[model samples]
Target chain A: MLIPGITIKKGVCQLLALNKFSVGQWLKTFDTIIFDADGVLWRGQQAIDGAPDTFNALRAMGKQAFICTNTSETSREKLCAKAQDLDFLIAEDEVMSSSEALARYLQQRKFNRKVYIMGGQGIADELECVGIESLPLDEGKMIGSQMVDYVKNITLDPQVGAVAVGLDKDFDMLKLAKVGCYLMDPKVLFLATNRDHSFPVAPGHFIPGSGAMVAAVESLAKRAPFSCGKPNTFICLHLLRQGVIKPERTLMVGDTLYTDIQLGYNCGFQTLLVGTGNNSLQDVAKLQRSKLPLMYQQIPDLYLPKLSDLLKFLPSRNC
Target chain B: MLIPGITIKKGVCQLLALNKFSVGQWLKTFDTIIFDADGVLWRGQQAIDGAPDTFNALRAMGKQAFICTNTSETSREKLCAKAQDLDFLIAEDEVMSSSEALARYLQQRKFNRKVYIMGGQGIADELECVGIESLPLDEGKMIGSQMVDYVKNITLDPQVGAVAVGLDKDFDMLKLAKVGCYLMDPKVLFLATNRDHSFPVAPGHFIPGSGAMVAAVESLAKRAPFSCGKPNTFICLHLLRQGVIKPERTLMVGDTLYTDIQLGYNCGFQTLLVGTGNNSLQDVAKLQRSKLPLMYQQIPDLYLPKLSDLLKFLPSRNC
Candidate 1:
């Protein structure tokens, strides 16, 4: 079958479309494959056509597959369950989420103090899994009608050693102010789950994401956060350090450019862009024309219309 | 009486302390004066010691004095009333607040459609004063428990032509999301009252300002707001355009450097820094050492211990 909407290209600078000849060669290059869950495998609650079979086929071929997402709204367990529900073979241990990354970061530091959270219950659950305590998410609300009264009456928790921000449904001014006060102590660690500004809810429709909440607190605190999601490089450094994957032999596949592609570039891994999510060939073409060297990092090594398109290039028995 | 904690210095690069010898010459250089409220005039409800007498004395010197503040919490009427209650002779029309500037901006554009506001009632009142209607401030809250439900069920008002943001006590994720949706249309105007990140609430304590709220929306919307307050130049450009004051002959007096001093530099007005608010000589010295040309804009032309210190330099009859 001919791939639609992709021109055959040869150079790494150009967005090369995976054809029968190139796909087979590309499959031999990467021993480990890291997939961005949301846009590559599925969008929202629905899995893309043939995505599950494509993912399962890669695993069946003896290729290591891991699900990496910037979502702070759910835990690894929930993500694994959702992936299983959508027919994609995934395990809790094979998933790495922003919230999970944050929890791991604290655990690595052996941080015992409580954390002030401005996110969903998932963040709290992740922290709890690591035996790290977090303040009640709802306790940050304003104590009175006036902002001054709230500012004057509210007291900062001396035990809070860090402030973690993620996509929050209940984000408000009081929480923003509370985070600001906690961050005033220079010793307090400021962490953000991810910095995806907006995420698509439907075709051409997007909603504010965790980055929006993080930006508010950052402005008030006058400091940038230590982000634990894609493009930060720190998220995937552990895998490289543990010798789980070699940079030259690893392939990072996703639908987003700035996060997935940039992360791949930062980690020295080959990147593949799929059209089922946030970006397309046009975005890559635009980036290719940019004068800045930084833009080149967002360009992918290869392109496919969707994840399922790769299944045809694999052996039928694997599928 | 000797002024405390000031070392006299010369040149614009140096933070020049106001002395008796230079006070008369400085007084004659400007026919009009702009004063920043809050720290310069008062701290909360209490007037800075001898501040009212100093202000009244400056007006008695035949200088046109105006109270310019970035506060969006109250109307011009309320600010004028507060000024009078604090013993300063002021007229309602003499106050140029952030909310007032925003209202005047819409009035100048002859905008007729309703505004979607994320601010205090003061913003709505100011818009009403100019015959423009704004959507109810409290109506933007989330309708359900889930962010997806809120995003799917909530509808954007077609009548809203502009989205105005200020220091909102009730700022939340829903308002941020609603603004994001409205801003998806390229025609909808995005306005911010000011970008003051944080304001001092008490000694060594600060609270999140309107800039915090604006930053969140700006990140989600992926657009910059046309700010109406200090440091934006638009706030005082009207004064220069209407021939109300000559920039060369006007003096901008305040306790903040980023807003008032930068506004003065942008407007070609002489800037005065008083040590009653956010910044001090330490900040000015730090800026002077910076290699960036932009940092020089924040260095004030003159400095005083407090607004009241200027009282000693003026004629007793004026006081």
Candidate 2:
């Protein structure tokens, strides 16, 4: 059903429901497709029904398919393995996780010093992939009960040049204190994987994301981190810079509005919102009614129940 | 020296330097005095010079002095003991800590459920003192490597009704997760000790305060906590309600502007800023020049190099 009262302006179709005809026309508009992993393709360990076939069909149609995920818990290798296990056709390098984006960002800057990581081993591995060294995560955990003694004896590694933050189950006060100490020197770079506040674990159940960890360190460090994930444009800079994907011909598909839709809007890509994830048509309608121009950026150009629904609209596929 | 550009209003004096005569007049203006312990009376374990004698002299002259501190790391009993150790004539009941204030807040509400504490033992002890039970601080620490397993096995205690956050060296993601889970039930109260971002440990050295812990949980919980510490009128409500102190005749003294002076401004109490703590005369001068009406609330009515400076100006004490 088409959402009522949303007027489509030139070059932007706000909350237009995609039918077979519209989907076919939409498919012809984008040569490159960026997919958000968690919500659009799968929910946790389970892939959205027919999502793999839809993704494969998109690639088979000569469209460049790239998976851009905000999850920093795993590296691209692991993400590729996960995607393959779910029967999606994917190349390892075509996937850009926030961790990978942050690693590339540091690599591009020629950052040579050791990193103080307040994230999981995924970030550490990504940095390692770029030949960057990170301090052992266990070193700061030895801060015993005596905070004063710990502060007095705290020896900041002079070689440490950056603090990379991501989602970590092991996040604690010791890490926060160490980050604060390192950040006291104005030269130390503060970087975050993403600022996504929370992600769904189950229906209506959400857990704290990397934003929580970043906020904690931010409170202590008294500074903001250079975020590399959506809606930050830094995540797709390499693709844009290398002319791999022309923005106008690219379609960004995801469930979340703030990250996926906003990123697509910022990058001048056509955005498709899928119901299998965080936001819904109702949310789009609410944003539409609010009349805030900023919120309008989060309203996707098209909407679908799930990514797999597009499979029927593919010209090569039998309805 | 008097702040040159500042103009003294009818009721508010912005950064008037306290000299012998002005200090005597200032002493006569307030019948009750509220002192901030950390920066005003002492820094770390060492007592600020002449602070104890100055405090005692004020009490000797029939002024009611109370130590209203934002430190939630210790109970009132411990605070009184520390004050006594530093040669201040402080009674156990005369000290009001953020922890104590939070405890009273819950007690006043007749809160019966167990508190999920994300703070030090001080908060737990304060809750216990007010006949409230808190969950064991170590229960959340046993969350092992597998977050999925932990989340799947997570059992929130039905009795837990509130999450009290303060400075905890042991603060971790597990606590944040638990708080997130508990807060999913909107009826659960979220309380914070204070929101002071950082506190001075030594000259030019600072450490993350309770605000860091609060910010972490806040990011996860997606709601602001009811802060019971300085600048929140709830902390001083009991004294004000009981007629123990009149706001106009009460002087709030401290080194921090945002907390102490802002609290004074909020409570209609005269504010005194001392240089020995987080803020200084320069900060006051800067605020004075900002011309923003809100910033003026942080500009103290009186200024002194240290709390002990008032000792020389007390009429009862010979210079």
Candidate 3:
């Protein structure tokens, strides 16, 4: 389980409030700062106020900033473009998204094989970029009783050595069955981008996340996938293998503790939870004392009102 | 929770080996017989040998029989027609399918409102026959990103007061979202036909069952529904309300213990497990001694090789 400088461990945590006295120490302690996209940087297409300047401030102090997101709808190139358009200057290489992480995972393992992807353009494009051909999920080809027939007649592609799952709007019974059938071969790896059950689009407006889709397929496949997103150290491990980010000298900043802060801790990084999104202070308080084994790592070492709040404690926004 | 003519308790059970001495007494004890269709009387399209003649012989002996199935693919009319084609003697009224049961449930509750059905034509036809209007989950209507916009732009039909889920081959992310959205209101009753995870279609082939679809929605909805099939007493309660089936005088027979045997107990009927489909003798043996709180009713009172095997103790079918 050892990956570079990262060591996985389990324990409860206490959140430390940011103050002027502790702000300088935070900026100089980390060589890289990893931030979650949706709630930490931007909500949908709109960037949270002062989020740009906060990253700039981190960079000005000689600390690198990376966007580590689980948003699977868009590819890394699109994510960089979107971030730039929102005034948050970002580069494609600095964007370690679930989509990109999956591709990296395949390449690092030297698994030069075609994939059957139950996902969207993010995964497809990433696979193509990584030189991994994907068996297309033809939406029009399968529906109603046709799904049964297709599954019956299906011949597993020998080239398809893996099945990659994510937040696929095109997810259907046919795709589910095909994946399950392919996974019947124990050697055929099952890879999921993330397992966030639901993500909030706006206040009180939540959509079923990729985890729901994953759960549906898992129910049929009778197995869990090697999920590459937060709370699983695979994403960070990928970064570690690349030699760009040092886990010991990294700070993980995010709005939610579950995927964000817990992921940071799993990868042996300093974790921070901001209160401007999905979870509340009370939610963290409950998880810190949670007896449920499932909530074991949902804790953080530090937290603030928002990522932008750190700007007040920074000296300058110039690198 | 005690019902008349039913005793509730616990402990391991022994499978009775029927002999000539006890066969006559077993036949005279129950005036009515409840059979689960897919695994017991039939497997997919083909009927188990001697199944048709067994029901006919039971009728000649003045015993009433019903085909109680969780297969939601076809309506009662179509089921009866299919039975006739397979040489099985079944009337429309005697075929109590999950689809028909759902419609009857709505009628019984007087919830005469439009339904949002995430199911097949069986449920649609049954609902129409019961005079309940439905908002169709037309497969062609929702797919890909269009699903996101459709879910967002969709206006809630105030008349839609319930959402029924079943075996839907067209099940996808869009349909999952729409149903989850509709069930946001606590007033919108959520109903599922059954929860059989995977059903064997052929010797080594299995298809993901209605339960997988239901699980997808339930994961998104964060709540379970009033599931109506085997193992749930609701279907039996519906029959009891009709005043034709006497619980004390009924015998429930099927191949699977999870649905058939537990359902028989849930409805206050004598249970008989047949080894013609799905489950094996070892499966039953394991369940008979299970101490899981949820599996208290899984043990059956009687079992044999098949329904046709009962002929050894009964008079010849001259009808």
> Which model, 2 or 3, shows the larger TM-score?
2
Choose 1 or 3, whichever is better by DockQ.
1
Cα lDDT of model 3 by residue, B1-319, tens digit = 2223334344322233435655666677789998888778887779889988787788788889888888887988999998889887778888888888788788878888899989888998998898989887667344656654556655668898999999888777667777877887888999998887777654334677888888777877778988887778776676698878888889898888778888888888888778888776678668756778567577777667788877766777553
Worst 10 residues of 2 chain A by lDDT: A1-10
Model 3 lDDT vs. the true structure?
0.78
Where does candidate 1 stray beyond 4 Å? Answer: A1-19, A139-144, A203-205, B1-21, B139-144
Question: Best by TM-score, which number?
Answer: 1
lDDT digits (tens) for residues B59-90 of candidate 1: 88888999999998799999999999999999
Q: What is the C-alpha RMSD of each candidate to the true structure, in Å?
A: 3.9, 3.9, 6.0
- Looking at model 1, the pairs that clash are none
Model 1: docking quality category:
medium
Distance from true location, Cα of B176 in model 1, Å: 0.5
State which candidate has the highest DockQ. 1
Candidates, ranked, DockQ: 1, 2, 3
Runs in model 2 deviating more than 4 A are A1-19, A139-144, A203-205, A285-293, A316-319, B1-19, B139-144, B202-205, B285-293, B315-319
List model 2 lDDT by residue over B1-319, tens digit each. 1333334554334333434555555567779999999989988888999999889998989999999999987888998999999999989999999999999999999999999888878899899998999998753363446676666556789899998998877777666776788888899999999998886564334567888888877888779999999999899899999999898889899889999999998999978888888897788778868868898788787777887766666756653
Weakest ten-residue segment in model 1 chain B by summed lDDT: B1-10
